[model samples]
Target: MERKIKIFMIDDDPDDREFFQIALDMTGIRYTLKTAESAVEALNIFPEFLELPDYIFLDLNMPLISGIQFLQIFRESADLNKVPIIIFSTSSYHKDIEDTKALGASHFLSKTSDIDRLSEVVVSILKGNDLPFILT
Candidate 1:
């Protein structure tokens, strides 16, 4: 049997999270989804997760602690820094993408209206494809 991919998503919007869950369910990808309303919540749970998630989808804009701040914190930590972190945000600004990539995000994906595109992006990330952002 193929191993199920473990995915952790740090998104503030409940609707977006639900949409992603529905999309994943429809795609039939063997994945485990975990949601965090804030980066603090994610950081709190990071240690307890049995293993590092195969993919981490993070939102750029959020209250309290932003995704960029989370990335900085994660980068400072040895244990969390090794895992693949993807900036899954609504922002499509060139500067935002560049800044995130420079800060060690594996990929910068804009929130898309198409579920098919989202699924494809997820699949590509899981398959270890050479994405357009930093893979560190």
Candidate 2:
């Protein structure tokens, strides 16, 4: 039996959070979404998690602690070794993609204003597919 997919997202933009949640809901997959506006806030609350999220959608930009910084810290946790980390960003830079992949990110997803496309991405990820943000 499939369990409810738990997703954790860290983004400072409220609109981004709301849009992503809507897209995720549209996938018709049972899920639970927990969001944090800042990496610092996310880190603080992370220890309280009773269960690990199926995936983590992380943004590259944020105040204080950038997403890249957070990724480094997050990867150090031996317990989270198997949890896939997906990079969520408006940036489609090749360097960003290469760097994150090297740092252990499973895939990169661009932040699109289109909800349908977002939903498609959500579905792809749930189906164990990748939507890589290639610079080309």
Candidate 3:
């Protein structure tokens, strides 16, 4: 049996987290989704996990430590560096995309209101497509 994908999502908004869960559920792919409302909470729980996440989705805006800050710290850890990090944010700013890409983010995707589109993007990423952004 194939192993299920492990996904970690860090976003302050509960609604956005719920949306992501819904999107993942729609994909029909085998995955375990874990969420943290803030970077601090994620960091606190990260080291406790027996198996690290296969992929991490980060939101740009948050109270205290932002996603970019979290990414820097996350990438600095030797054990966490190899995991693919995707910047999943509501911001459509070019600078945000450029910054995260320079910091080693695997992909940057704008948060979509459409759940189906989000599901498609998740499927593409899981399939190992090299595209930086998933065009609707």
Highest-scoring model, lDDT: 3
What TM-scores do the predictions have?
A: 0.91, 0.92, 0.95
Ten-residue region with minimum lDDT total, candidate 1? 127-136
**Candidate 3 Cα lDDT to native:** 0.89
- Against the true structure, candidate 3 reaches a TM-score of 0.95
Compared with the true structure, what per-residue lDDT tens digits does model 2 show for residues 1-136? 7789999999999999999999998999999999999999999989999998999999998999998889999999899867888888998877888888888988788888889988987798878864564311
Ten-residue region with minimum lDDT total, candidate 2:
127-136
Task: List the lowest-lDDT window of 10 residues for candidate 3.
Answer: 127-136
Candidates 1 and 3 compared by TM-score, better number: 3
Which scores better on lDDT, 1 or 3? 3
Specify the highest-TM-score model's number.
3
lDDT of 1 by residue, 2-76 (tens): 899899999999988987887777767799899999998998998898889988999989998999999998889
lDDT against the true structure, each candidate: 0.85, 0.87, 0.89
The best-first sequence of candidates by TM-score reads 3, 2, 1
Instruction: Provide the clashing-pair count of each candidate structure.
Output: 0, 0, 0
Stretches off by above 4 angstroms in model 2 are 130-136
Q: In candidate 1, residue 89 scores what lDDT?
A: 90
